[model samples]
Target: MQITKCLHTALLVADLARAEHFYGTVLDLPKAERPLNFLGAWYQVEDYQIHLIVAESVPADLVNSEKLGRNRHLAFSVTDLAAAKDQLLVHGCSIQMSASGRPALFTQDPDGNVIELGETQLA
Candidate 1:
């Protein structure tokens, strides 16, 4: 069987309100109408969607602690890397520039979910 495309990525969040603020308010992702009768929120990014599922606890385990971008992350393309970094900082989000000298930066959500932003286009 051949794969077509990725429909969405579900992330477990401990606090729904904080997650919604980060993804919705901070990141400015459009909220998508979800029909599931559960505690969660959905954000639409281009053709893809991010599903935030509420959980009792979300582990902040990172395989590579030195580099946050090396861990599990959701990457997105931005028009300006500098402006993106500035916005994240203004919202009190800690960010890490790509160690590989790429035009990208990595940050974490309230639940410690890694998010990568770059000026380059994503395939």
Candidate 2:
């Protein structure tokens, strides 16, 4: 059987409230619908859903420094990389430009999940 649909991506966090604030405020991901018994938060991003699960301990170094340009990361397109970089800097976040020289920058969440925000291209 071939897998076709991917429903959601689940990420572990130390605190649910902190994760909520980080995602809700920083990334501006809207709170998606979840079952009442669910213990975590669900955020709707485009056609996908991000589920933040509360974990006792989160792993460190999820973002590799050496392979940043070639590493695993969640990428999103922004209108302006310079503006985004400045805004992220305001929040004390580090921005790493793509080693390939593309108009993109990388950062992470409170739990150290690697994220890349790239400038969108207009057709």
Candidate 3:
């Protein structure tokens, strides 16, 4: 069967409240829904959602969770990269530029999850 869409993406965090503040308040992602049984919160972006899950411990197979790098990243296209970077900085998030230059900036969430914010450069 073919996959039509990505239902959600999950990130494990040590603290749910901090993750909620970062993803919900700092990143400005709208809350879709949260279940009491599930130890996570769903944050909606354009057509998809990022799920931040609180876990007591991280699995050994989680490579990205061990180290924050470029390989594992979530890229978001924005109208203004500079403005987005400024806002993220105000939230105390660290920013980095992509190899392509100033069109994009990379940063991490409260749990050190890499997120890329860039301007949609259409050819």
Q: What's the lDDT for all of these models? A: 0.93, 0.82, 0.77
Q: Write the per-residue lDDT of candidate 2 for residues 14-96, one digit (tens) a residue.
A: 88998888788877789998886857899997888888888899888544676565566778788888888888888787778
Candidate 2 regions exceeding 4 Å error are: 1-5
Instruction: Give TM-scores for every candidate, taking all chains together and pairing residue i with residue i.
Output: 0.95, 0.84, 0.82
For model 3, name the residue pairs that clash.
none
Ranking by TM-score: 1, 2, 3
Residues 1-123 of candidate 3: C-alpha lDDT, one tens digit per residue: 999998778888888898898888877889987766878889898789887878897543326533334457777788878788888889888877776665887787776678888798667
User: How far off is residue 106 in model 1, in Å?
Assistant: 0.4
lDDT of 1 by residue, 1-104 (tens): 99999999999999999999999989999999999999999999888999999999899888996799889999999988998999999999999999999899
Minimum summed lDDT over a 10-residue window in model 1 is located at 114-123
Largest lDDT belongs to which candidate? 1
Q: What lDDT score goes with residue 76 in model 3?
A: 77
Residue 41 in model 2: lDDT: 90
Error of 3 at 37 (Å): 0.9
Which predicted model would earn the best TM-score? 1
Error of 1 at 10 (Å): 0.1
- Give the clash count for each candidate: 0, 0, 0
